[model samples]
Target: MATEAPKRSRFKRTLITMFKVGLYGSLLGLIALVVAVGIAMSQLPTYQELVRRDNLGQMIRVRAADGSTLVSLGPSFGRWLTSDQIPEIMKKAMVAVEDRRFYYHPGVDPVGIARGIQVSFQKDDKVRGVSTISQQLARNIFLTSDRSYGRKVREGILALALERKFSKEQILELYLNRVYFGGGAYGIDAASRRFFGHSADTLSLAEAAIIAGLVKAPSNYSPTADAEAARSRASVVIELMRKNGEITGSEAFAAEPADVRIVPTPKQNSVRYFTDWVLPQLDTLIEENIEPIEVWTTLDPNMQRLADQVINANTPAGAQGALVALDRDGSIRAMVGGRDYVRSIYNRATQANRQPGSSFKLFVYLSALEFGYKPDSMVEDKPITIGSWSPRNNNRGFAGAVPLRQAFAQSINTVSVRLAQEVGFRTVADMAQRFGVTTKVSTHPSMALGSSEVRLIDMTRAFAAVAAKGVAVVPYGIRRVTTAEGELLYQHESDESRVLVAPHVAAQMTDLMQAAVLTGTGRAAQIGRPVAGKTGTTSSNKDGWFLGFSSGLTTGVWMGRDDNKAIPGLQGGRAPAQAFHDFMSRAVASRPVEQFETQVAPPDWAETEPDEEVWYDSPSNQGQMVDADGNPIAPPPAGEAPLTQTEDPRRPQQEETLEDLVERAIDPERRERPQVPPRPAERAPPPRDRGSAGDPVERRSPTPQP
Candidate 1:
């Protein structure tokens, strides 16, 4: 009996020792946690500063020329709402989905964290977020989105501080006022208005659920982006609200997805592309200030809507289309970057650089004109070889001799190459740059056929220069920028004297392009009024382009796949030209018909200075060539041939002077006028066979390595 008693005492002593060790260890850990939290607390902003802070960030509101809102560029906030002003359903939905234990927890929820840890273990260590409403508010206000242990510690400390400083209603109010929703919308009020077109006080149960669901992933759950997905997410939130007893089963059932009608947000609008392009230019135009500014852009809302419709209707499946329209003064009238801005935000019109194909011939032919080649000047269109590279016409058969007008209209590859060679390739590259083509131009032989990549906007501006009668056209979107209080910040101004191409040269080029629309590859772009354009089809049908102008407006259309793969049978004249035709027909209907000026006098600034250095070597000169100074050089000895020569045409009965030839080229009788059909009130139905025999396909030439 005595031995048993001693054994029992020993057992008791051991139990006491183990308990003491555990107590000491837990106390030490608590002390360390307190110290760490104290350090984090010291780094945080004071509660008063957080409460008083306004102006989350600079917001830019872009408006169309007609004073319609196009888009808002940065964080957009609506009026703040007090706890009473906020809808009850919105508050209940937010709490049910975001934090069920908001009022019960001291800041962080231990139960939610434990559940999250369990879920992570069960799901192969995929971390699950356990942030309470307080934690999210803390992070949104005073923290960056850094996912690290130290950041979490700071976040938790801040949450504790916020909870201690404010009541549950105040915390909820702050959260609802500051949380980000998709499409630049911040705060529940803004989100409510953005998605439902009404204030938060009028939110339906389903609408409230939809906004609450966006808290987890604003972009993924935005109703504007994907309505079906948003509805699915909202259903989940409605069920959560039901389970939390915030609403009855009947209330959840009544809150159907169909009951929610999502209003179109600015990001979903097609004009986002234009506004996005214009946003960066603001930094250059105005001083950097924190005040919200309004940008009045040159966008024509009607034209923009039409452009969007045209691109969506014309772009083939599995391919993309872009259109850029500019006024004569280089004001961007309309821009559609792609068929669907919601599907892709990449502005193909301004951002994509693709080969322009025959569309680039504008520079080549413009260079030819500057070098004193008349549109009627005959050039050989037969196959030509340039340093191990042989280029042929699209048909692979040659028209032995053709006028420059016919050659350009047909997009004859060999003719372009010959002209690029005769007029130094460097001259052609410089001409393109002078016309506002900002992309680097290659001086290679194939570059004449548009082997070099160029942006759609730059190409459109070059055409706008032609439409502007040779004046330099610097494309611009913003007409004026002003503060919200009506203080003028910046306004657009132009230099009328900066001439790009000579007026006469631009006139002649217009004649050539008019002929192209009348009887060439761009016949698909024929509007009732005078229209001039060029069609471009790149290698393997990778890129298609049509740049044209009429009635003081110039528009460029590009169609291609983003992957740079061949869109089978795609040609510039097939879709791009037709799209241009449909858009321009309606766009110019309100205005009176205006004829292209056949005879344009050079501007005063341009009259005195020589337009460009001419290196004219007439094909009819019988092996003789002119130097840069216009001095004729002796022909090569008999039986010796020039590097390249036109097939000798039957000698003219009487040799014609250069002026006579130019006069004949400019004569209305010699120019091929389009056979005009009776004008209809509405657009003519697109011809079924857009890819007819005459549609010019710009053939790709093997680019010779330098």
Candidate 2:
């Protein structure tokens, strides 16, 4: 018994010695770990240096005259709210969904880490991360989204350092402001403005919960696009808040199924096309930096909405349309690029180059007026061929020797051809180009009947230039740009060049266009007010347009298929004219109604006539009027050798003009295209008295030709 007791005592002593050694070894190992962590922490960026880092990426905000935002181009948002400024419910939401034990954790959650490791090993799910809120902030601020081991280690280490340097509130604030909430929103304040149209401080409990749920897979949980998944996720968030004691069960239930309707930001609308257009201009105006700048634009939200409604409601199925409204100064007040911005982002208003049809006649007439043609000039609308191309008017009819004003009003194709041939085609093409037609013009007699393709915005601006009384006007949007602190950055300068059209010529053209509204093919645009405009329909009804001006505003509407298919019965005077009438009616509703200025005065040659013979044309007078220099204006006699028809004797069968095969060939139905020949109507008599074309007039029929 004594020997057994001695052996037990020895074993006990040996166990005590081994226990002491192990305890000391563990203490040494823990001390070594502490030293290693301290060294690592010292190697990181200094706390002050880290806090100084900033990324307030610019959100180029385009605003209207009323100080309301139209759209934000980059990193979109309003203001930054500190933790104190943020609502308590928003804070609770963040803590409940992101990290329940945020207050207790030093930097990393050991329990979460253990679970993550087990899940990774069991299911090989690398995405089941154990990143705490601080770690997430570290990743967002200083790291890429790469899933490398190096990134994770750096994230954890930075998280620990952040926790040591910042208090709990600071860490949470940093996390809230740095995390992305998807949909181009980068912070809590940005997300609040994006989905709710208010500041973060104004977020309701339901809004807070909805945004909280977006912390994981924001796009999938987007309430705007995927409301079902977003609501389900919000319900999960409310339940989590209840589980974490952040809210009561009643509160969770009340907020779970809340009907969330997002007050959409204007940035989501088709006006984004306008903003995109102006952003590149800003690039030249301002230096690139993180600070945001404000651009005061010429957008009228009311008019813009009206335009969008008109286009979306009026366009045919699977068809596209564009509208542009500009003031006399060439400020773009409203622009709708397409029917819907989501389906197609292309800005048809400024980018599309569709044929202008009869709308091109405006410049042709303007050029004729500039070259000393009176509004009362006479043109025979018979089948007068020009070269191989024999253009024919739509509807298979013609007026014999219609007054120039009547010819333009009726859109008599033969008359336009005669006029273009009388005044050099170069003069007409030059006039259109000067008035802002950018497309290459064919100068064929067909061009006089609107044969050139032009962007809607450019054509509208060209008309706006005329409304400005002959001063060339460039359409501008951004009026002024300012820094966030209200410091002047840049201001727009107007290029009001007056070299495009002559004053007398513009006045006369305006007079003739008003006659068009009174009795012309554009009768559909009658708005119970004096207006000046033109109608255009391309070959095959492929494009239709109405460009008009009212109350010092010019708006153009273009309709066509992106695939260039003919629209049945679509004509410039049909849908396009009516749509222009609707848009202008609303656009001018708030302004005082006024008549277009029709300042009629005698031409340079009218003063030469005596009182008794003033209205009489002398035998010495040629077909053309003289210029200010009194040089007797002479044009080649109107009847040129009747243009011979191009003949093809190969098998002795068919003959066609180049323009017939090329520009005007697509129309199987009557596209209302221009003419080379046509059935002649009874000759029209000269009017008893010709006045300025502001009001409609009746003319006696001329001597009929067999």
Which candidate leads the pack in TM-score? 2
Candidates in order, TM-scores: namely 0.67, 0.79
Question: Against the unseen true structure, what C-alpha lDDT does each candidate score?
Answer: 0.80, 0.74
lDDT for model 1, please. Answer: 0.80
How far out, in Å, is residue 601 in model 1?
4.4
Clashes of 2: 13
Q: Determine which window of 10 residues in candidate 1 has minimal summed lDDT.
A: 673-682
In candidate 1, clashing pairs total: 0
lDDT of 1 at 429: 87
- What C-alpha lDDT, on a 0 to 100 scale, does residue 496 get in candidate 2? 71
Q: After superposition, how far is residue 169 of candidate 1 from its true place, in Å?
A: 3.6
Off-target runs (Cα >4 Å) in candidate 1 are: 1-74, 95-136, 143-164, 181-184, 213-258, 264-296, 312-320, 336-361, 371-426, 439-455, 480-490, 537-544, 559-573, 601-706
